[model samples]
Target: MKRSAAAFFVSVAVLAAGNGVRADGPDEHAGRAQEYILANDFDEARKELARGKPDDVGIATERARLALYEADCDGALVTLSSPDVAKTEQGAMLADIARGCARVTAANVLEEDHDQGVWIRYQDENDRALTPLIIETVVKAREALTRDLGATWPKPTRIVVVRDLLSLSAMTGLPYESAQTTGTVAVAKWGRVTLLSPRASIHGYSWRDTVAHELTHLAVTRATVDRAPLWLQEGVAKREEVRWREPGPFDDRPSPDAIAARGIELKLDLPLDKLGPSIAMLPSADAALVAFSEVASFVRFFASSTPPGSLERLFAALRDGKEPDSALEIASSGNLKQWDTKWRAYLQSKPKEPLPPLLSLGKEPAPNPKAPSLREVRERMRLAELLLARKHPTEALSELERLQLVGAAGAPQDDPSYRYLRGRVLMALADPGRTKEAEVLFQDPKEVLSSYGPWWALRGVLARSRNDEAIAEPSFAEAVATDPFDVEAACETLDADSPTPPSKDPSPLCQSARAWKVPSGTED
Candidate 1:
């Protein structure tokens, strides 16, 4: 989700009325600054402010507004709280918003790290594990966005990973219920990317993609100078989210087109025009998903139909104060309505039977009260793991079989932990048919990719068993990528002939994984 404010021009009008002064009366420089700020031309705004008296309240407020647009919340607060600006009506309103920014960012950030042009902040040292991945994603995403949208990062971009929903709400000013209802784990606001940690989600999320999505919002803000409407902002972001990585396809299984097609069939699709404000504020999780899918599909359609660099021109038009409909006219075939009709016809041509799963906060499904308690389930899983570790394959297999029987009522059939353990047991037994069955269990690479280390490591093992180096290599790489602290996954990615692979360009995680040693109890 990307947070947008009501028009700044409206605020400027309110400030003028409250002070009983004409907006352009006796402060022409301040008035010009306000116009530049609305156009998202901060450099021009700064130049205009320089022409005014430094202590002027209107100049000070516009300066603070520019800082806010750039995600410099602390700077904005300082300007707003200065003696000359603090007492004025305009300053007071800007100050209040700055205070919220302080609460969301500076007040909550407990730790920080930097790499290249990116900085990451979090409350826990444990989240250090995510720093490398965040940096990697941002570095790649920055390049992709620059190439595609001509967006630039004027300063080091910041990524703040908060631990829970309360922190997320405080940071983004999204109501707690709205975020919970729509399963919004992240938002591009305060000129930074603020997100919940992957640990906040029970099954974990495609956080790398989420990071790319939010980063795209920041890019759109920059390219359009805060002029992008919610639909265009979100639509472009969704279209670019997966473009930052290899094998990244916009039309993967249950793709945007597929989801949008299904949403249209169900008549649940929100019109792009009616996706009021933000998808995070949609009525339900289903609405949010449908809306996202719809916009993503439309953006893809719009981008494909237009000539190369049409998106860049679109952003330029928006930044220059063109209305969205007119911007579309500049970017594509003249009539927005006709293009939308063509997009709909294109969407209807997509496969819609397998609708993507409804979007959620990636929370675990609540256990059925009549079924076994979660603790009991964990204990049983642990017992099976211990038996396997002790070389008691028969007992491990038996225990796992019993676990399946008891947990079938409530446990997710695709739970990665269970599959990993069962796959391990099957490997231990050394039965050819069972090994094949284990391969079947681990074959769903998308599921493995979204899961934790165990599933990824297990998939790597299965791939190696079949002498499939192509699958084994990426699987092991993903295992380390998923959980840097997982010794098995880390060590698995190391080459047999040498401690490290021969690649000249090794990732930070890969370097760590190559050097990491397996714990004593773990098998080679």
Candidate 2:
């Protein structure tokens, strides 16, 4: 075994090439080196960095972070003063942690567990407890992917769990903002997949689903040379996400009719050809969500309504080098314009079901001299609440806005409880412009006054919507504490809780939570 990360790196360096690389200059050298490091090609990364002999501190910093990746804390610390090292927050943190890492007596080493044809790489023995679950999920993911793709990945598929978004972004070339907006569970590169370590605490993502999602990506990328359009590829991947504990293997596809109904509500819905490049580039988080829903609905509907080989044939076309639109046209046996007409007709024919009742009725508004009485406000609010509860958010929002103008005294807009109601209505409307309004309302200083379970639950919802799950978890906890019966708060908080829904959560506030089942939804 190697004595230190430096020894391990040296061995890899020598194996990659006896001599190191030479570069034209530091900037290009550092950029190429970081690119290699991101790909986990440490040998080439080291070689690339060494080419410059790195007079610049900024260049030296890249080498330092690489050393840390190999757990060579002593080596990493030597370049702590380098400006290149201090260039990024991630680098500064790496420098700060180097000393503590050096003092640890235990040998820093990665552990591997292989079973069947799949293998997982963990940072150390700390993940031993999770290895069994990891292996189980890998096996399931491989099985599910193989079943769908009609091909077995004979070679070992490595699953590498990384430390944080910064590390993942560097490795994958995905920006941190894109990662958060897309709710990226894991990325499947050529030979292996990388996921955020369980320690990173991205609450609410399911490892099982993530493994399944990435496995599908790997298989599909291999099948199509990664040429499949983003929408179809993602639609196929979404189809692969299934809950492991279901009574038996279930398709797990959301009802196309229901999703289409949702699409009708959100006017931003696009046809298969128009789903756009990737979900990450969508204008808002709501647009991303709606886009995914529409594509998933379209793909599943097309498969069921058409011949079984339609999807397989589309992939085949892509494999044969046809463009995405052409492939889609071939799969549907009709042009996209024609398909759009059929899809629209299908959407209109499906039964319309109302969204679940989310708004609670309130007491009548009271009277005041300057404006409408509290009794009048409540009466109008009740009408709006009924509209919202009945799934008429557009009408509800209009009614609520009118109530706000009725008078200065006890205006619904001034009350946190009323503001919360309006926020929810805005969300139900799924309009991007309304999202900011909802955000302002949720962030109001008066939120603390309500202390009600629903109020806190809305606060959690707003936070989670912005990908601020850390803020969300505590609010969710507060909701559960205020009322243990609030299932939505309990479920939303599950991501930040145990890896699996706990049989017994330590918090007395959530004691009753153990008995509730987490509903199937895409948290990962």
Candidate 3:
């Protein structure tokens, strides 16, 4: 997805060589390199070139081009350095061209936007007028941060939205390399939010929610500067999104459902002294989700019970370099322990609703009796799900391919789930060559099946591929937490050496565990 011409160039060179005529001159070799790059054969292009030579100006230029294509601007600079390059007629021109390319690539990779002071880019490949909407949302978010946290809020933040996932990922180096990645990602440096196009299509719901979520991260980062704890930052962000969504004035009080869902007894009162420390890091997916959910719930309670302007006061204290506990006490007019007790009492008194039993597919036989005899197409889907559950992703893919053909007649458009499933299967296959295809498919918003356990698990796999352990860990946890029985087998596969699985029971308020079901007729 990170557009590299090196591979393309290499392929063209190989194909040209296969025609039984080797390139004789600098121009011919350079032409071949251009062709290979166009064809996406970077390896072949690199193979055809001579390295570190001043005599071959064409080869040197091609190498510089290849370096730029591969995102190695530094390499490009070094490749362009030659005495012959300075003296030759075309050499100086080629060197200038290479330098310009390197500069643009470097700016794209590292520099923030001059106007907004954020690295955010608005993409409109489909030529949609979504840029205005992004600007509006950012303005609103900024206002909310200023009103709530005043001097503690960071300035010059940027927000980006891409029309397609692949371009977004390629540009941001984010997990999944696309907007179609399951959700939004916040790049801390510029406080940039990258929203995939499909997710953006949800309009009022998806885009606004994502903006609120990412902005909360930005606000918390500013509130604590570099001193914030990871759990606290994530927790506060999660809580703020839900809070901002409530109707009328911004009341700190959480919805009754949120209060009831988070149990009073399980409240985590992590000491400010130990809060930023890494002792709470959980390798197990289940533990991590629980921790995130618990911290989110805790923040919600704290905000709801505290006096008006208390949150603002706390931010002000932090900005003045006060210790966290002292700042909290000054803000609330009491120690955190007292606030904790009050929050616990408030939660206990709230009305409660019993949660549905965790989906127990292991003990109970499959309940969807209609699943077997529905149709050949539906049956294939069922088979694919079963195969995925059994960890036979290859077999599942074969079945899905057949299903895709069968469904092509009547259900051509309703194949997001199929594509999503196939993407997962490919990830499970784990061949490095297939990572690109897998990433592309995963970026399709339609491929994200909210109700499917394996879908989230596959997202986890893709996240891991991109080295995003923070996002991946929670995604894996969501899979197991969504349906403990179905994902129990897969959870075992994640940590075979550990023997005992961490608690798979859903937390009182598992954020992602709450279904992301879109209406049946909705299309992005």
Candidate 4:
């Protein structure tokens, strides 16, 4: 969280003035506004000042606070027109503070380089918005992975930061059907890159761990490319996350007895080379989770069982384009299939623990006539996003409907979030009967959600249906611009070449699209 030096200094000056000022009066209100500004709660401070009796200090102070928080000087200046605020000592001090904030914010905004994919655009009332932090995290993760895991790291890496969870889901086509939402996802194509949701907390091990996990995917993907196995990919990614001490609470080393007690069980008999393409398209969610877990376990096994140099030798074989079966055979001196079978038999023979109770089940129904809160709606929407990511549209739609019901009850009808999610859920269904419903959401210009990748993708689809290549082109372009690492969106933008009036400056998107030339028959 970045803070301006001027804001910090002003906050200190305000705090030093002390509580000798009485409560329940204008001075007390002024002190509260200053406190709120320091805490980065500009919205509440603005509301408080707006509702109170006329006071120069309250209005000017609030303006300064907004400017400092949003990095929007123009917006702050426009709000400082209160008559009472135009004539006071506090007003003069606020003018200086506002000017300093404006300079700092403008400098920071202007200094950001868009072409390099260094900063992400986002709005927040608090300290530096999540976009910049996500970008920095990705850079740090890539550097760490490249430094620690030399031969395995992918080349020409990039990172993308989406504005919201819904946008993140839209880019990855990850449905919001499940409860747990992913903070980041990696797609290793022309280069290794990760797309992260900026809304997630950027501090602590959770965020760092997500970066490590995604970077591991990049390393494993680079090692295997087309020949990478699912189990190996997942296992390596998980191992890398833990290897970096990122798995945090889950990182304790098991006692030798405990490790023996929890015997290794590789359930699937599939060879490692075959794992790459099949794991993503697994028919059952349970099967997919099991596959991922098994992969993690297998990587852990290799990391523990083999000599230090053995893992590097295995990676070298993978880098040389050897199949996992051959690579494992050469590196470990064992038959890959036989080893897999042994591991599976070992797993099946172990005593299995009972699964935990489902949180979605056995919950009391909501009280009759009570609508869900915005937070509840947001959470359900997040689940819908996960379901979509997991490729479960039917289940995602169920959650979307619940979200719509909540939205209909006094939530802003024009809210972009509701429309965007609805559009995505409908698009995933791909039923012609639902096209109009999806179109309704896509066509809303006021939809705040339209700025996101999925919404733009849906818009492109709608435009394509109407043979309006102009509209479709920009929409696809916007999607790619927002998520530079999205292969699907990049393809759509490249294939779509309609001479549309530029909705946005087309230079960046067009340049990026042109630069992304996939090998003739490569599947990303």
By TM-score, the best candidate is: 1
- Deviation of model 1 at 82, angstroms: 6.3
- Higher-ranked by lDDT: 3 or 4: 4
Q: What is the lDDT of residue 223 in candidate 4?
A: 47
Residue pairs with clashing backbones, model 2: 57-84, 58-84, 204-495, 365-374, 365-375, 365-378, 366-373, 366-374, 366-375, 367-373
Between candidates 2 and 4, which one is better according to TM-score?
Answer: 2
Off by over 4 Å in 4: 1-128, 131-148, 151-156, 163-186, 196-207, 224-226, 250-280, 345-355, 359-524
Residues 253-317, candidate 4: write the lDDT tens digits.
22111232232232333344454343434443333444445566666666676666666677678
For 365-483, candidate 1 gives per-residue lDDT tens digits of 44566556556666676777788878787788887676543334333455566777788888778788888877887887555213456678768866775678898877776665445
Write candidate 2's Cα lDDT for 199-305 as tens digits. 34312234455666666766666566456666666677666655222421113223435545665665657666665545645554445555655666666667677
Q: Where does candidate 2 stray beyond 4 Å?
A: 1-111, 123-128, 198-203, 243-257, 356-524
Q: For residues 1-524, could you state the per-residue lDDT of candidate 3 as single tens digits?
A: 01111111110000001111122235566656644543335666766664323356677766665664454556766866777555555445445545543443342323344554343444543312334444555666666666655523333455545545344444334333222222222222223454444323222123444466567655654454334445455556555553443332212222323423442233333432343322123222222233444456666677777777777677667646576678888888776667656655665666764422121111222234333232665667667767776778789878877644532432232234555556766766778866677767544333322223444556665776577778567665544423322222234223223222344443322222122323222322
Global lDDT scores for all candidate models: 0.65, 0.55, 0.46, 0.46
| Candidate 4 accuracy as TM-score | 0.38
Model 1 clashing residue pairs (backbone): none
What would you estimate as the lDDT of candidate 1? 0.65
The deviation in Å at residue 481 for candidate 1 is 5.2
Q: Which ten residues in a row have the lowest lDDT in candidate 3?
A: 8-17
